[model samples]
Target: MSFLNTLNLTGKDKSVGLLLGLILLSHTERTGAKDKSNVVQKGKGSTAKLKEIMIGRCFNYLGTINPNAGNKDCSKLWEAFLRAFSEKDPCKITKEDYKPFLNMADHDIPIGQSIFWSQTKELILQYTDVTHKVMPLENTLIGFMLDGLNWCGKLSSPGPNYEACPEWNSCTNHSMGSFWRAASENYAMKAQGEVTVLLNGSANAFRENSIFREIELGKLDSKRVTSVHLWIMDNIDGPDKESCGVGSVAVLENILKEKKIKYTCVDNYKPVKMLQCVFKLDRPSCNTGT
Candidate 1:
């Protein structure tokens, strides 16, 4: 009190100091609110952007394949697809949850043109693109839409949780894993006539747990499909481990035989070997087609 009296503090000075303090507090609060708003906005914006890209690409591919496919409202499709996993436990999402979206995109896969691959994604894509004789899963509308994308959502969140999503092996019922399981089942069930499978000969080419072995093999209808053509492609650098009637491939043959589904295995088919040679011309294995 003595110091205030010495300085001659009056009502106007006191009021001015209080007003300045209030302004500073208000500004700080406003800035913090704006920052929080921006963070929320950015998260929402990113999720929307991903949806747009995925749905847009799907529609574009559909339109290119079937002109009437463009008439479908893909935005609605996106909404339906997101609703499958959004606001749900990432580990609890199931193949059945994706049935709605699948129904919307359902179409017949060209018989005999269906190609399945295990650890041969690159070569199969290249082979399909160059030859245009096979239709891999990635060529399908649904597969084209979600391939290589990671997404999940929470009940508390409004959109996909871009911060973190489970990996393929992290959980049995992971969102992406469920989607692929559902998609593979559809693809396999729809396949007819002769179906081609491209396998990597260098590794365990045919494993029971592989999608090709578990989903595709089980779904193929013996009444519809005449046979299965297994193309075992090895690396140009040697170390070819599996072949027809040998190793894991023989196990695969036994399964097919038991199923009464006629199958033929070709080790390093010349055309595929030629394709490999395009990438590694100097490799003796590539040159010799061994």
Candidate 2:
């Protein structure tokens, strides 16, 4: 009575207030349960943003490089890419998962225009960009669109997750590595005629499990690929670790013989050396103008 007297609330008014309170409590509980069911991890970058960049690159590739790969529906291609790993365990994604996406984005490589590289990534990119006479996996649409990006999915999220992804070695079948394996295999299979392989003359050159070794080299059709031209490049300064017919390079040569793929090897192929010199003129080794 004393509490009701303060605001003069009647019995009916009290009942109405009780009902409203119950409604609010029920709404709050429902909202909480809904949020709990929608578990998600925000990736470091937006999946939408990745889609934007990828699709833009897709249109650019068709416009500039492979107009012959006609009528590509980029939206559909992106869907295929998403379907590869959506709602799947990041650690379980296999190379086979990406087959649909790869098949959608495939384009032919010109004869003698395929380039494979290991341990010489930047120089090889420079050569491809400067010369525009060859194509590497990174230059092809399947590789180009996704090269620098990292993405993964979660059981809680239907698509790419945010805030975190397992490191490359976190699992044997992590999404990115598997995708690249499929891409490398497709690239190698598409290659025809002589293929140029750029190797680091200062390192093992052919790392035992590198994509170039496991996927690209093995998938290369001996019937299609005539010879492999290995460009063993070392820094202009020093620290030459291995070169043609020596060390890891020799091991690769033996494998090539077993496969019966004719090959040639060169130390610091002049064109690449010249390209390297262009940006590193301060080095005496690059100062060849005499």
Candidate 3:
């Protein structure tokens, strides 16, 4: 048995013991020879800080951003989220664990405006910000609060590990992956009228195992979804890898068609491409004002 188990420590005992071990290890590392290469990366702590950020964003969503967003209590939402993975093995957290949390965070997505993208996230961000006429998952309340953050909990305690969370590839039910899967599934289930996806023509835009393909596509309801639109964009100077009715684009179209869904694919969509050229306006291709 481990030292903690030998002592019959439980609950707070084990938590404090673990924290002390981390502090001692840090001191030892500091006292030893400096080695930047040996630096350790850590997942975000699920503590007051993460809670504060979540709550703040929740209130912002209900107030400043979209006052019409469904009624929700930020504190209770945090409790539901905490109840999802707390005291569970990080690698064993299934998407189902977050169902309660997703239920609580649910809000209506504006009709025909949900934007899904793969491999071209930054481009989509610029596109959505410039247009503000579309809504990416990242713009939603849950995604807004947790974007770029990592969190995981432990089976041995009721609180988060605050040390190292499992890497997404470590298991099929990885904590972070589970959360996104549940969120993406929830988002897809709520999509209405029209759906839009942004894809990079330079790369394999359609990955078989992406969240968009795995969770989102299958969950889309034909009765509720009217059409799907694919914006296949390539860099200004390009070895174009894919486009409408070509390459993986063909694969995506086939998938949607097999589902009896209507779609439109545009290659290097002009408005988004124009945003890309903002930084390189002096380029020959960008100098079109004759």
Error of 1 at 29 (Å): 30
Better of 1 and 2 by lDDT: 2
**Model 2: lDDT to the true structure:** 0.83
> Each prediction's TM-score against the native?
0.81, 0.82, 0.81
> In what order do the candidates fall by lDDT, top score first?
2, 3, 1
Candidate 1 runs further than 4 Å off: 1-48, 65-71, 288-290
Q: Give one digit per residue, the lDDT tens place, for model 1 in 71-129.
A: 56688878888998887767679999999998887766777988999988989988988
Q: What ranges in model 2 sit over 4 Å off? A: 1-48
**Candidate with the larger lDDT of 2 and 3:** 2
> Candidate 1 versus the native: TM-score?
0.81
Give the alpha carbon lDDT tens digit for every residue of 152-200 in model 2. Answer: 7766568776656667776898888899888888888888898999998
Which ranges of candidate 3 are over 4 A from the true structure? 1-48, 283-290
Deviation in angstroms for 106 in model 3?
A: 0.2
> How many clashes does each candidate structure show, in the order listed?
0, 5, 0
Q: Alpha carbon lDDT of residue 125, candidate 3?
A: 88
For model 3, what is the error of residue 132's alpha carbon versus the real structure, in angstroms, after optimal superposition? 1.8
Model 1 root-mean-square deviation: 9.8
